[model samples]
Target: AAAVGATKQELTLSIAIVSLFSLLFLLAEPYAAMGLGLSDDVAGAWIGGTVDLTGGVVAGAAVVSARCEEVAAIIKMTQNSALGVYILLIAVLASRSGLGGKDAASPAPPAKGEGLVYGLWKKFPKFVLGYLFCSVVASSLADRERGIAVPLLGGVARWWFAIGFSGLGFSTSFRSLREQLDGPNVLVHY
Candidate 1:
């Protein structure tokens, strides 16, 4: 968001719109797939890829079956883990290509091989690091050694994920939302 100079509200609105179909897709896909005589794995994978939110994908898959939940969770996590790489690539390209606007608060380019690391580090999104770290810790902690703590950990993770997803709704501006003015802005997120 910083690299592109997007405000928190803009980011939230974009994400919320993109994920607006998640709930509907989740509720319909499982039964629809079964009615079509599709396999659980195929249905689960479709739901996971189609649903933008990780927590929603997992929970919705569980409603179908354990196998479906496992497949959906795997696909969703893989997609989530790809986020850091995607953002990093965008950062690198944006920095090198001068994509930002004139008002963008970009740092001065360093001399070749001088402060390059620091420059990249400055451009890097720190949230991606934290996100990846939390994912790793959560998976690592999901071992059999956790015993009774597993359910607690799962609940906490779900709660955190739900709160994170809700940032979209909470950050939305009522003015724009109520006025329904922003078809162009909405298309830009695509």
Candidate 2:
């Protein structure tokens, strides 16, 4: 949603974060399974929790096993289910701190002579309702079968994933990356 007008480099950096995490987790899965002797489910849960992003969690878990991928996807989706609550909390906090409802695009509802819900109505995003509704409907329709559920929701996920990477692939300039990586900031970060 926030990806409206960020520069190509900024977009690529966001993409790279997930990509790097996926690569790191994929490489570390071997050690986690062998050197650490963590089971597939446990490793999957760990990746799911740490990766945070849905695409990275799925991709990272795929290296371990199909079962791991399933577990990681479930955990990540579960985590995503709390997005509405997070948004609500953020809106309420922003409203309380007077950080929200100041923008002309989203006018603040009056507080005087109005209920608390009214005050927050201007701050809350309308799309969150759609998100929660879809989650609930999908949860109701969720099946264990790969042929059905995978194509149902997983295909949509993969499509969005592809679109994101495809944008990065097309927009990312090699020279830009080189400059970003060669700066004094790189040395400090490293």
Per-residue accuracy of model 1 over 107-133 as CA lDDT, tens digit each: 444446755465566667786887777
Candidate with the greatest TM-score versus the true structure: 1
Worst 10 residues of 2 by lDDT: 1-10
- C-alpha RMSD of each candidate structure in angstroms: 4.2, 6.0
Judge candidate 1 at residue 71 and give its lDDT.
93
What's each prediction's clash count? 0, 0
lDDT of each: 0.70, 0.65
Best by lDDT: 1
Kindly report which residue pairs in candidate 2 clash with one another: none
